[model samples]
Target: MKVIAFGASTSSTSINKALATYTAGLVDGAEVKVLNISDYSVPMFSEDLEKEIGQAEGAQAFLRDLADADALVISYAEHNGHYPAAFKNLFDWATRIDREVFKNKPAVYLSTSPGPGGAQSVLAAAVGSAPFFAGNVKASLSVPNFYDVFDLEAGQVKDDAVNAQLKEAVAKLA
Candidate 1:
C-alpha cells in the first residue's frame, strides 16, 4: 500500500514534522512520501488573487498530492490553538481548488507539542473540519510532552506506554 504523510508544516526543524515522520514508519507495508510545505507555497487565499492569476501551480500540486494518496498521515503543530500558518495557507489553497480535496482517504490524524496537551485543540479542530475534505477518520494519536516521550536524536519513542499506544493506533489505521 502507498501512504502519503506530511508534517503539515514547512519548518526544517519542526517537532510536528519529526512526529509525522516517526508515525509514518509505524505503518506496516506502505510507502510513505513526506511533503515539504515550502514546495507547495501559494499566495494568501483571496478572491481578488484568484481572479487575477487563477490557481497557482502550488495549489495544483497540493491537490495532486491528496488526489494520489491512498491514505494520509498528518501531525499538526498548533499555533495559538489552531493550525500553523504554513499549513493553514496550504489548506486554504487546496480547498480553493476543491473543498473535498482529500477524497475520503483514510487518515491517521496526529498532533504533537512540547507541552502536555500535544496540540489537542488543533487535532480536535482537524477531526471536526477534516470530513469536509472527505477525510475517512481512522485513528488519532496525540503525543503529549513530546520532549519527554520521544527521543529526538534516536528518532524513536522512549516511553513504553506511549509507544504501545502508538502501535495500536497505527495498526488500526494501517
Candidate 2:
C-alpha cells in the first residue's frame, strides 16, 4: 500500500514530523512518503489573496500528494492548544481545491508535545474535523511529555507502553 505521512508543522526540526516518519516506517511492507509542509508553502488563504495570486502550484501539489495516498499517518504539532498556522494555511488552500481533501483514505492520527497534554487539543480538533474532509481516521495516539518518551538518538519511542500503543495504532492501518 502507498502511505503518505506528514507532520502538521513548519518547524525544520519538528518533533511531530519525527514521530510521523517513525510511525510510517513501522507499517510493514507499505511504501511510505514523508512530506514536509514547508515544502508546500502558500500565501495565507483569503478571498483577496486568491483573487490576486490565483491558485498556488505548491498547494495543488500538496493536494495531489494526498490524492495519491492509499493511507496516511499524520502527527499534529500544537501551538497554544491549536494547530500551527502552517498546517492551518495548507488545509485552507487544499479545502478550496477539494472539499474532501483527505479523499476518504484511512488515517492514523498522532500528536506529541513537550508538555503532559501531548497536544491533545489539536489532536481532538483533527479527529473532529478530519471526517468532514473525508479523512477516514482509523486510530489516534497522543504521546505526552515528548522529550521524555521519545528517544531522539534512537529515533523511536522510548517508553515501552507508548511504543506498544503506537505499534498497535499503526497496525490498524492494514
Candidate 3:
C-alpha cells in the first residue's frame, strides 16, 4: 500500500506530526510518504483570491499527492478546539480544485494534544467533514496528554492503553 501521512499542522514541534509518522511506520510493508503542511503553502483561500489567482501550484501539488495515495494517515492538531489555520487553508484550496479531495482513500485519522481532551474536537470535525470529501475513514484514535503518553526521542507511544488503541487503528489500515 502507498500510505501518505501528514500532521494537520505547521508547527516545527508538532506532537501530532510525531504521532502520524509513528503510526504510519507501524503499517507493515506499506510505502509511507510524510507531508509537512508548511511545505505545501498556498495563499489563504477566498473568493477574491481565487479571482485574482486562478489556481495555486502548491495546492495542485498537494492534491496530486493525495491523489497518488492508496491510504492516508492524518493526525490533526487542534488550536482553540479547531483545525490550525495552515491546514484549513490547504484544505480549502484543495477542495476548490476538487470536492472529493480525499479521493475515496481509506484513512486512519488521529489526533493528540498536551491536554486531556486530546484534540478530540478537531478530530470530530474531521470525521464529520471527511465523508463529503471522500475520505474513507476506517479508524480514528486520539491520544490524550500527549507529552505523558508519547516518547519523542524513542518515537513511540509509552502508554500501554494508548499504544494498544493505536495498534488496532493501524491494523485497520492494513
What are the C-alpha RMSDs, in order, of all predicted structures? 1.1, 0.9, 0.8
Residue 156 lDDT in model 1? 87
Q: Which of the predicted structures, 1 or 3, would earn the higher TM-score when compared with the native? A: 3
Quantify all predictions' global Cα lDDT against the true fold: 0.85, 0.92, 0.92
Write one digit per residue (lDDT tens) for candidate 1, span 6-109. 88778898888888778778888888888877889788878899899998789899888877778888888899999988789878878888889788888888
Residue by residue across 80-117, what tens digits does model 2's lDDT show?
Answer: 99999988998898888888999889899999999899
lDDT (Cα, 0-100) at 48 in candidate 3: 97
Give the C-alpha lDDT of model 2.
0.92
Stretches of candidate 3 above 4 Å error?
none
Candidate 2 regions off by >4 Å?
A: none
Per-candidate clashes come to: 0, 0, 0
Rank list by lDDT: 2, 3, 1
Q: Estimate each model's TM-score.
A: 0.95, 0.97, 0.97
lDDT of 1: 0.85
